[model samples]
Target: MNSLKIVSLVFFVRSMEQIPCPCCGERLNVIGSRRRKYLTSQSLPQVVVIRRLRCCRCGRIHHELPDFLVPYKRYAGEAIEPVVANELPLSVAVDESTITRWRQWFAERAEHFAGCLESIRIRFGYGFVGGPSDLSLSVLQRIWHYVGDAPAWLARVVRTVANTNQWVHTRSAFCPSWQGYTIML
Candidate 1:
């Protein structure tokens, strides 16, 4: 996630060689590309072509997923924000069961997410902004004050968490306050 560049499909397609592989710490070679169908909040679903790259050293394949696209999920995280914030999402692309899983996942990780965000604010010399604390807010709304009205607000929020700590993808917080347990969300 740290090495990922939030670039256009055209830019990624044209410059796949410049990107490094997340798996093996090797320069990536363009192996091929594939089209994926994803949904937005309104209108028919859109299809975008994403490039597939191989690690020149480890020979592992990696899909160059866009920041907007949630890995292994059909609907963008942005598309699901409304549903997470309020009522159920009425869409054919996503199912209630999937949304249930998302809610449960968020509930499980909300505290960790909040503490990380608070750390980010502290690191930047900005203490808490007098908004909803992690315990008082839903995971989706935890950082609303920080995110503000930015376009693609979901992406920016996620980018903040992703940029804050690279190991969040596969490891649990290594704080003494946290009981030693692996978090693989």
Candidate 2:
């Protein structure tokens, strides 16, 4: 019953208060923090220390990951956005290997991710309003149009969808807890 929530980017840079459980909607207790090596626009891996919280009611462990870092993705969404946009990231030159993996990852769930954006567009009315809502474009495009290239845009989108119960975060991006093709990471 663990779930993910989007705390501010400041959460990663500094200490923060407790978050509510995405599952039970109860207050989460700050248990501890974990350090993960994150990918930046640079080729180097930057270490980001993230906080961990546990739901008092469900006892599910929730990791407070920055919105920039998608679960299972080595690079932050910032690093991936430009590549997804058909442009290179301004700061760092990530190798094709990482880009290839990103493409493969997107290709694997293109429809599902697009569906997530479609649902969000219908509800939020802020992104991707063209050429039918049947996911003819890449999911990344649809998301970008709606949320823009803001630093934590992906997490904001995910938060909105999760609020509607169309998605759930169980740590892994490929977690079995997600209900359908409409789910987002």
Candidate 3:
């Protein structure tokens, strides 16, 4: 029974080595792997499989593929950070639904990333200093959209800050009660 289990495991692992390293032309070592599910604009579900590889000789880590996301995808914790914050489209073919799906996927994986960051913060004992309290509504929208799935307290803080910022900006535009406020973020 144990031998059969071992054989299956070996077969499964061997299958992951089918993709060769671009630089070395050798079977890359599997460092890690993950699968992300995304919903299309039509509400169709699709899965993206990501595999991380390392070149044994050069000690360089990279993804092995037909270049899924352009150059290459690094499976770092902060990989999606820029995507969430940046307004520019990473790919010309990428649509609004695609971006939204990517954000949802990132949110789903945020807990793991947050835990890793927390560990580093604890080890280094670093602190965040106060910055300018004032922020634009657009900036707040980005923040709220990105960290929407964070802890309840954090979400509340983002909402409060964004609301205050919006209130201050539109105070003179119209009556406070007549001001239109929509929470897109």
| CA deviation > 4 Å runs, candidate 3 | 1-83, 86-93, 127-185
- Look at candidate 3 and tell me the lDDT of residue 10: 13
List the pairs of residues colliding in candidate 2. 127-146
- Estimate the TM-score for candidate 2: 0.63
Q: What is the Cα-based lDDT of residue 106 in candidate 2? A: 56
Per-prediction TM-score to the true structure, in the order listed = 0.54, 0.63, 0.26
Candidate 3's displacement at residue 3, Å, is 55
Model 1 lDDT tens row, 48-71: 788887889989777766778665
Q: List the residue pairs that clash in candidate 1.
A: none
Residues 10-120 of candidate 2 have per-residue lDDT tens digits of: 235433655668778888788888887776767556778887878899998877766667667777777766665566434556777778777766565545555776676
Worst 10 residues of 2 by lDDT: 6-15
Please name the candidate that would achieve the greatest lDDT relative to the true structure. 2
Scanning candidate 1 in windows of ten residues, the lowest lDDT window is: 8-17
